[model samples]
Target: MATAKTRQKILQTFLDLLSEHPYEDVSLPMIAAAAKVKLSDMRSAFASKLQLVAAFTEKIDTAVLDGVDEDMGDQPPRDRLFDVLMTRIDVLAAHKEAVRALHVAARHDPALALDFNRLEVRSQKWMLIAAGIDVSGVKATIVAQGLAVAFARVVGVWLEEDDEGMPRTMARLDKELDKGGSFMKRLNGLERAAKGVRSLLKRISDRPARRRPRADEDDGEPDLSDKAPAGA
Candidate 1:
């Protein structure tokens, strides 16, 4: 089996090249050459570009999530998300140029976007976990998708943002969080409404069906047999 060390080397090389060139131009041979690895070794580590992207994202996710802040646990959801996303930005700052290039390419490439979206949603699930937020069911799915979009937008800003401190990037992130808060409120309302509907339907379903009138009652005939039967 290829060691983790070798795989990481290959991924990092691809990221470096991706930053310096267009995504369409960055081929497997370029990555292999940049990584100083044989083509065979590079293939062993990553069979294709999509696999390379997925592995790159997984490594980045692990880097941020593996060391979460206990302090964040005591914070509000928005604040926690702010910290989580900002921490990710800090990691991303190193590859801002590459990420910027990828974002532009993905906008024009539907196939790339679709494959990347899968990885992005998966990454956001971990980010939610890091932020002490739930990541399950329909509402959680919405939240995850929203965060993925928010992060992508932030990366766009971060790429163009030249300051060492990234003041503009921070401002954009805050705005996105504000928007997310509003969206979540609406989502919560919808979820509550849906839950209520489900509960009502359950009650209606669980209630015993209305008893039908007996045949004698329906016919308006008394049980004369019973009246006449008592020890007669």
Candidate 2:
């Protein structure tokens, strides 16, 4: 129920403070002062510091996804996945401090970890679905999680390195993607297979049932209990 203006002010304050300090060193009072809002107001909007951090992280994720989605028109499936992931890496690299804070907070905050994972999984699924892949099966989920973790590690390395190592780091990812089967292709294949299976099952289930003869139509019922007692 917060006003747009108030939300904008809070976000601006957070960005300003983030540029000047590490995540661990930031406090509510400092953020309020930077945002020109009262500490109570900040607290009212975000229940805790961790929630503020999550909000900031979500804002960054949204911006990156928006940029990728805007530019993904008519691109091939592989290219779209690669482009989106690289764009996200670039965004995180540009906001290294903020990214670092979120990484650190994720280690100590279970809720943050769950939220972050959910966002990541959703984005990956969206990319796969856009590429005409089904994201319903267990295998698809595992593959998506694996790709996300790998991409995250790559981004982490890119953020931690200097200009000299950036090319080498990117080259490594390119080589990895090219040398082995493309992660995007695997995801798409799994999705297609899942869809095919689902379609087959649906078709089978939708077919008309065949009539069978009733038990009463038989000539007679066997008397097995009488025969067994006579065996003694």
Candidate 3:
């Protein structure tokens, strides 16, 4: 509908204004003026400033997700994860205003924060799947969730500084992944050791014990209760 287009235009205008000023300083009338739409027209599209901000955020999320899926197609797991993260960084850099607005709004909106958390989890799941890791178990799920949150924090730090560009962000990502690889290697070693210990115990328990002379026969006395000591 035409109303939809007008609403989108107003949101875009708001994003444009964000590039010029911080989100806290932006006003509805200023957004309307920038969009060249009347204040009443803007109100018709959104009931309130918060609603408008939410709509803008939804638009940006859609745009970023669309681009992410396209860039991630048919790649190897590690490549996919790297590309996905780099794409996110690039999208945020390109649409800094929209991203900044969402970041600002997330502080005040619990639902928005939840949405962001879910998005990160989804990304981590995809990466783990690509890596051929089984992400169904509780431990795997927790690792994925943790990694996603850590990655998001890294992206946030990158956004906070003007000098930390995409290449620098990508480098940081590589370093983080390297550290993750080391951690995973250590975890795998522990798992292997645990498995070995379990197997050893099973083998020992399953094997028949060597025959020995009864204690009564050796000492010419009846064995008491035929039971091993508590320590044994």
Candidate 4:
């Protein structure tokens, strides 16, 4: 078998083990044995357990992105995102138990959770792009991050969605997407407000300041302090 095939097998075996065993107890040797690859060759696939999980996420992300529907061009942004996210859920459905196991691990491991979210955000950026949404600049970053968080929540619902058709999961995703849309609208409003403030500040700064009057150039008003009784 090719090296790539062997490596993929190791990853799959690790996830399979993860589904059945605790992450802290799963061993590389176990993965190697289960994958039917020698420990020596398995070392070439993953140096640590976390690396195996990262590779799994990358593989799933690639699969979801490859399945993007170009026919969603005319749909609204939310619909486009809905379709792509559903496709992602489809790809994840097979690994539900493995994912549930990881979620349990993450809840107890802040460092691992943060690291995993880093990868998840990257995946969400591709999802945004695949959905025909803009993934550029600060706005793109904000949208992608919001989608990452929302997607995680949606996946949590998906893991328990025994209905096969996933109606409940779809409703949860729709609600989350609507929440994200509202947030994006607010963010855009803030951006617009910020731009307006910046323009106003620039205009103020560009206008020449009025020169302070020196001891010279007084008006024609009389010195009332000394001459106030002149008329009297």
Instruction: Encode model 4's per-residue lDDT on 1-232: one tens digit a residue.
Output: 3388788788888889988987877899988888898888877778888788889888988998889888888999899999999999999888888998888788789998888787788888888888888758888777888888898888888887799899999999999999998998899899999999999999999999998767666756666777667767
Instruction: Name the weakest run of 10 consecutive residues (lDDT summed) in model 4.
Output: 214-223
lDDT per residue as tens, model 1, 141-198: 7898998999888888888888989899999999999999999899889889999999
Residue-level lDDT tens digits of model 3 in 1-232: 2387898798778778777776667788888888988878977887666676556545544555566665455666566667666665665577775666667666677876776666656656655554445657665766677677667666666776677545666777888777777776787788789889999999999999988878556666656755878776
- Greater-lDDT candidate between 2 and 3: 3
Evaluated against the true structure, the overall lDDT of model 2 is: 0.66
- What is the lDDT of every predicted structure here? 0.87, 0.66, 0.69, 0.86
Off by over 4 Å in 3: 48-50, 68-74, 101-148, 160-165, 175-232
Query: Residue 146 of candidate 2: its Cα lDDT?
Result: 64
Cα shift from native, residue 127, model 2 (Å): 5.9
Q: Candidate 4 has which clashing residue pairs, if any?
A: none
Most TM-score-accurate candidate: 1
**Models ranked on lDDT:** 1, 4, 3, 2
Runs off by more than 4 Å, candidate 1: 211-232
TM-score of 1: 0.88
Q: What is residue 12's positional error in candidate 3, in angstroms? A: 1.0
Cα misplacement distance, residue 154 of candidate 2 (Å): 1.9
